[model samples]
Target chain A: MKARVTVTLKSGVLDPQGQAIAGSLKSLGFANVGLVRQGKTFDLTLDETDPERARAAVADMCEKLLANTVIENYAIEITA
Target chain B: MKARVTVTLKSGVLDPQGQAIAGSLKSLGFANVGLVRQGKTFDLTLDETDPERARAAVADMCEKLLANTVIENYAIEITA
Candidate 1:
């Protein structure tokens, strides 16, 4: 099975990288750009075949290491 | 409009970050994990209401700065 995990910063947390990107966009003539929040994604190919088991394992991984639970939120998507 | 851009490393590229994550998982007792590729996701809120324009602008941003075109591929998603 294949699983994807997206980790994003919690709202209200300062994102300097996103701000820089937004500024660069404006400088490059893309004035319509607004708030930008950058995040991380992990695409994992697991040996497990069960979607349920795979998702559970990945979720554990996220909680234990992939994400900072206090400041970041993570979502998991499973594809068999 | 809201747009999401996911940037991933090209296949065959060495991803030490992903490798480190995988190693950590193993140390933490999650042995089912296989190949892991780490990537970036940017969630953008644009002033433009048109989905088409928002996606195009985000794509341009990806090509110019968000992604290393030589070794990364990006996918854009637009939401109104």
Candidate 2:
């Protein structure tokens, strides 16, 4: 099975890295760029075959380690 | 308009960060985890309204700055 997890900062949270990227973009001539928020993606190859079990397991992983729920949000996708 | 860019390491590329995360997961009791690869997601709010133009511009950004084409691939999605 394969699972994908996307972890993004919650709205209203300050993202210094994103801001820096935006500034760089402007300097690089992409002045039309607005807010740029950076996040993370995790691609996982799992041994579990069952789709339901895989999703549940990956969801647990997201909650436990893949994401910091206080200031970040996560979305999971699983494929068998 | 909003655009999303997902940047991932190409196959066969060494990802030390992903390896470290996998190690942490194993220590955290996720023994079932297999190959774990980490990537990046960029959420961009663009002033451009035309979907085609937004996609093109973001693609250029990815090619030039958001991703290293030598060892990474990027996918772009634009939403109006």
Candidate 3:
């Protein structure tokens, strides 16, 4: 099974990296750019054979070690 | 308008960060875990009022600044 996980900062958190990218874009003449928030993505190939178990385990993995739940949100997409 | 962009390393590229994470997971007793690849995500609120133009411009921004084309791939999701 394959899984894709995305972890993003919750709203109202200051994203210095995103802000720096936005500033660089503006300096490079990208007028259309505005606010930017940076996040993380994970692609994993699980050893699990059971689809339901794999999904649950991956979600647990995200919550436990992959994301900071207090200030971040995560979503998982699974493919078999 | 809001956009979410996901950037990932292409297959065959070495991801040391992901390997370290996976090693940590194994050490912490996550037996179901296997291969892990680390990537990046971006969330932005574009200044443009036009939705179509905003999408195009943001895609360009990813291509130009957010992702490394040689070994990375990106995807965008837009919400109004």
Q: TM-score of each candidate?
A: 0.97, 0.97, 0.91
The DockQ scores of all candidates, in the order shown, are 0.91, 0.91, 0.80
Q: Residue B68 lDDT in model 3? A: 94
Decide which is better by lDDT, 1 or 2.
Answer: 2
Better model by lDDT, 1 or 3? 1
Interface RMSD of 2: 0.6
Cα RMSDs of all predictions? 0.9, 0.9, 1.5
Q: Where does candidate 2 stray beyond 4 Å?
A: none
TM-score of chain B of 1: 0.96
Steric clash pairs (candidate 2): none
Provide the lDDT at A57 for model 2: 84
What TM value does model 2 have?
Answer: 0.97
lDDT of each: 0.93, 0.94, 0.87
The CAPRI-style docking tier of model 1 reads high
lDDT of 3 by residue, A1-80 (tens): 89888899999988999999989889877877788899998888888778889889888887789999999999888899
